[model samples]
Target: MTRLPASLLPEGLTAAVEEASGARVVAVRPRGGGGASRDGAELDLAWPDGRTASAYMNYDVHRAGAGDDASFLREAAVLRALSGPLALAGVRVAPYYASVPDQRALVCGLVAGCDRFGAITDPVQRDALAADFMAQLAALHRIDIAKQPIEGMGPIESADVFARRRIAGLRAGNSGRAWDPLIHLALDWLEANIPADMPPPAIVHGDAGPGNFLFEGDRVTALLDWELVHYGDPMADLAMLCLRMLFQGFVPLPQAFAAYEAAGGHSVDRARLRFWRLLFQTAFARRSRYDDPDAPPPPNLGMNLVYSTIHRRVLSQALAEAAGVALPPVAMPDAAPGAHDRSFAVALDDIRDTIVPRLSDQQAAVKAKGLARLIKWWRAIERYQPGFHAAERLEISAALRRDFPDHGAAWSAFCQAVSDGGIETEAAIILCNAHAAREAALLADSMGGLAETRLAPLD
Candidate 1:
């Protein structure tokens, strides 16, 4: 076992973890898939009674903690609320050990497994794991939220009230930002399409999807990532699972739904599921003002861009499906070589060819790849975006019945029209889809498998 100085963590944090674990920390291995807001690690421990154990730690670097009844506090609180009930229901969840709000950290018993369902290689084994995961999800959804009250999530309400609250919450988050017209249209559609009725709300794992659950062999070890937990439609989880399947492969939706229903979960409500899918995607895909040339990128710049591209494209597609419109094929621009093209190519080669291989640390290598993606995007914008902008501007100008001196001006006007409902629904949907498709093409090479992923048919 290894122990280090107290300074490695915030004051009193190390002691808090050790006291909760009743063991000494030996090894701290960085857990992957952290974003700018959060990070964590797996800690190998040695107990005095000749027992060995491991625990996972989550560090909220953004410290979305502290405020009374803060929404972010639910991340750790929900685990505490559900762990017992879920275990009693034959579902496995990580055991909560401690919450250190002062340090924005949480410790829980580590469940050994990997989150990448795509890596299971064997078809039979992968299917088994996904089925098992569905069982766990079903069991979770079956838990009676009414009977097992979770505090700090606000009082339970009817589905319509819940829907309105969700809309309000999203508006609050979008406040004080440069509005993206697609977001405005998406929000309107979401507000209009709230189901007349919904099943009884349960504790929905709001971000449930591939890469958020762990599995080993034929068993799902535990579901991970509870940052977005809330009491709402459990179908939200299924919908998000579909989204994750597009990014990280899971079993086909038909098979997955079968497993869930078989496990005593409610039958799949396709319309409701799609509504939540649209909600989840649109809520996350809103544009931020980070494209300014002088603005500095956070360390994980690639994650930001790739996630944005995926969400934007998915949101566009979801709108089309919901609106009963078809997206006409979008045009691709021919590459226009620039003075910086060779320099861009040289840097990309150095990253994929030279830098990533020499990095032994898995987490570091992941960061290096992300850096490479940032460069690829820059390269793309230089070589192809001019043509893309030109074509897109022409399309928008015709739709708006006005001509702008520049693409930037045309786009700004188009966005204003869409946001103001000056454009018809079909035209807006097609325009948004066309724009998303072009953006997707630019990021396709960097996104790889995820670029071609489509929503599973809801049959």
Candidate 2:
């Protein structure tokens, strides 16, 4: 193995070419980020017969440690075993000696393929992309996992554990104050109704969706990004795919399901599909509340998924009552974006600038808790971070009270005082506290919020 320049590789990875193959590295390139992104690189290598070709490399940030090399080798082995039979396959990654000192980053070959997101706007392209995705999924599902134990993967067979883990991820990041009561109630409801049993699990690309693949015209040139691969019920993948579709607002629900089924996917029981769909959607709703940039553009150009989820619940209940069915507790709140993106943006900026700086001195352990992190963030907002203009914060707080009337009598009384045109200085101070309180509450309250009363329901 020849030593490559440290400057040639990313800050964390070690690079070398195989001497036996007469492969000599010649060049490198860089790429961008998306849903399941690994940074990209292009390697021009000279072969033994005086011929040269380029092999693309992708370095995933998640697999940055030495221990992960075996797991990655296993993933590459899975692809290598299956690539030959699939209708199309990106060149399966080749294992190379890793010199990565950090255990949180990775580097691998890049595949030159087109993105599907760019194609969704075009009709012919969308169909072709869907066909490619379905074909790839079917091929992946058909693989025989009974042979060697695929390392670093496990069976997520327990319904109780699955639900608990999902709920924990949500709660783990929450500040346990005003929002805790409602979030806990929702969790309790979900726990009581944990489906009795799930179907047999299969090898699933734990996080599968359109954005994770690459398209060459209508055909999938490569199935990119496999970090979350695991063994799970096939319906989990199916439900998540449909959820992505809905979030994209591409078509009617039944039509999307019909299209998927037509693309060679076995149609699971509709009820089961709906169960997984709602479960995945709720997880998404909670995760999106944290302001992730990559989440499918808010279903209707809207930012507040908490408001959206709650509004959906209200409608679901209203419809159930109309149909003479037992209406479950429509306790789901309106999960809408804050009345002004500006406020959230302002708050977030304060977190980045003022809050993070002061807390730079805090131990990383305290920084890990969501509430502690948020409180540290709020202290920054009140002092140096101008989360909301003084007058604006007051107005927003008053508005939040009306929008989330279920925030109980305490909040109602507080908002009532502000709504009555109180002093700007007093109102601003109160609103700042309320703003922090509400954010803390939302994290606790199942990570959602109410829709502003002024806006009509989205169609």
Q: Highest lDDT: which candidate?
A: 1
Model 2, range 227-302, lDDT digits (tens) per residue?
5455555666666566454333333345445555675655655555545554554444332333544322321111
User: For each candidate, what TM-score against the reference?
Assistant: 0.89, 0.52
Clash counts per candidate, in order, are 0, 27
For 1-459, candidate 1 gives per-residue lDDT tens digits of: 244625344467677777766877777765543443355667776788988777888765444221223445676777776665445776677887777665557778888888788877899997888788888888888878778777656677665566777777776656444567677778889999999768788777777768888888989888887777777887888998887777777777888999889988888898889888888888767664466454444436677678778888889988887889988888887976866989988988998888888976555777888888878777788888999999999999889999988999998898878767789988888888888888888888788777777877766
Model 1: colliding residue pairs: none
Q: Which stretches of candidate 2 lie over 4 Å from their true place?
A: 1-5, 16-25, 34-40, 45-109, 117-125, 147-152, 155-164, 168-186, 246-253, 278-459
Residue 267 alpha-carbon offset, candidate 2, angstroms: 2.2
